[model samples]
Target: MRQVKHLLADKGSVVHSVSPAAPVIDAIRMMAEHHVGALIVMDGQRLAGIVSERDYARKVVLKGRSSSATPIAEIMTTEVVTVSPEDSVDHCMRLCTERRVRHLPVVDADRVGGVLSIGDLVKAVISEQTEQIEQLQRYIAG
Candidate 1:
């Protein structure tokens, strides 16, 4: 029953973002510098969309488009799937599986708490499983 809040605490609440109006090249640069695969596209205070390396690969490189000339809004995914801080890791895993999304922004009480990636959910699940296995082993020994 691990929640997103627990997960976010493990990682920090550091959200890397860029403006929708920013060039795709800039967003890519920022992501590379931060060593993140995705960047939250912000329109002022609102979460406009998300731009990812996949988007750049498919929408720009594959399409033979110029990254410097294209705006993030043009390549970003606007229908952002989000999760709550109180949401269960199981629920988040289902969302990721069904929606085929790699990342989800965590929203709590009308505010952005953090972002969760598929990798994060998998890590949490694996850790939970490992802990359960250890507990079972201890019980058997006792």
Candidate 2:
């Protein structure tokens, strides 16, 4: 199976993040601009939390909170689950499934490397499977 590093190399390590001090609306706007469902809430060099559209819906809309007034820190998921570059794609899949999180930030030596969505992992797994199937078929024919 491919490692997280390989995935990052293909996808590029562009981490779109927002400051925890920013308002929820700012985070939402940033997400829209980036065409991403979530944004890593960074406090300087620290990974403060993660804010997603789901977080906005559940914490702000459902709770009747004002997005413009609410800070990202208030709604963002602070107990983030992170992975290293060396971690396997399978490991990331398991973590996303068990933790019920859509995003996993890749950390290397306490620094943010990149963010992987569940879609990224699924796509990588499918590609790997497809390649394996083709190899098997070629071997069987020969």
Candidate 3:
């Protein structure tokens, strides 16, 4: 089974993060610049929480809160679900489905490695399936 380490190797383990004390607007801007839906919220080197567009919509826009005035800590999801690089892609998919989350931070021994979005997992699954299908077809032809 393909592991997260392989995925990280393919995708690169560059973690896009924001300080918990940063204004929501800044996080939003960073997400836009990075073309990501979410960002890891870090307090120094430690992972504090996660802030996503969903959080901004539900907590800021819906509540009529000012993005510039609100800190990411106020809207970020503190109880984040995480995975490790050694974990299988299937395990990550299960976690995502069970937790009803779109993003999972890859952490190992308190070190933040990378973040996986649902799209990443889906693409990986599709690629894996395609390879398997091709292999089966070749085997049958031979």
**All-Cα superposition RMSD per candidate:** 0.8, 0.6, 0.6
lDDT for each residue of candidate 3 in 37-114, tens digit (9 for 90 to 100): 999999999999999999999999999999999999999999999999999999999999999999999999999999
**Alpha-carbon local distance difference test for all models:** 0.92, 0.96, 0.96
TM per model? 0.97, 0.98, 0.98
lDDT of 2 at 115: 97
Candidate 1 worst ten-residue window by lDDT: 106-115
Across 45-129, the per-residue lDDT of candidate 2 in tens digits comes to 9999899999999999999999999999999999999999999999999999999999999999999999999999999999999
Better of 1 and 2 by lDDT: 2
Q: What TM-score does structure 1 among the candidates reach? A: 0.97
Clashing pairs in 2: none
Pairs of residues clashing in candidate 1: none
Q: Where does candidate 3 clash, by residue pair? A: none
List runs of model 2 lying over 4 Å from the truth: none
RMSD in angstroms, candidate 2?
Answer: 0.6
